[model samples]
Target: MKNQEGHDNSMNTLNRTTVSLLTCVVLFASFAYAQGEYGANDFRIKVDARGQVASFHDAVHRRERLVPTQPAPLVAVKKGDKTEEPSRAEFEKEPPLIRLHYEDCGVSLDIAVQETESHVSFEIIRAEPSDKVDAVIWGTVSCDHQQDGG
Candidate 1:
């Protein structure tokens, strides 16, 4: 009876230790994913005709031009019977600008590139449907242009 009680206590200790270890591992993994690295050389941006956006891993240079060459269509206004085109700055400041379709969520999101850094920082400035808020997603980039084929 004494030996059996000792063995049961030992098993309980082992089970507790295993559970603690698993809990620690799960917390660490969640933290890691939340602070994951996303950088210019590490990911690629996709923009569709309707302005929907997406991102993917950039395996190859795929060095296509960054933006379309043609100017975006301008809105014309008639003021006192005189027609005028919207100014360049007006077009530049448009928001909800790039729509993004989230395949997993079955919901579309709008995104904006807030900032780009050569070395350690990059930020996704905005996302929309407005529900997601203006949280910034930042990560490090391998700024070694030579090594990265930049």
Candidate 2:
């Protein structure tokens, strides 16, 4: 009886420990995904949790082009008249991709990020529920001019 009771207590302790570890992992993952930065050469871009461009910087030029507080998204799906942007975004480093999720529209957009010596490019590789999508809006960016009086 004594051994059985001890074993049961040990099992309960183990279960509690497991649950605590799993909770920590989830919290850490969320914190990590809160923001992401991608860069190459003289350019860098930081994306917020909602997948909006938080910062577009040119190191050589010393300029930040995107308005971090702007409500406009870098990409939006126009379904009929409503423009739906991603409610959440996760960044993946391997092959470089930003996975955007639109919960209301029940769709996902995968934007591929490609960087070169001179520039960075973003291309939408996949858009789910293509039929429901009317148009893709790029951006209404509030930015500083890259150059003066050109």
* True-structure lDDT of candidate 1: 0.35
Q: Mind giving the per-residue lDDT tens digits that candidate 2 earns over 19-123? A: 999999976565466766878888787888897888878787777877667675768788987988879888776667787888888888888888887877889
lDDT of each: 0.35, 0.79
Question: What range of 10 consecutive residues in model 2 has the weakest lDDT sum?
Answer: 1-10
CA displacement after TM-score superposition, residue 110 of candidate 2 (Å): 0.9
Candidate 1: TM-score? 0.26
Give per-residue CA lDDT, model 1, range 1-150, as digits (tens).
226556667677789999999999976544232112223643444433323222333446544323343332212223244433223210112221333334322334333334244322322343334452323222111222334434
TM-score of each: 0.26, 0.71
Superposed model 1: Cα runs more than 4 Å off: 1-7, 33-61, 64-150
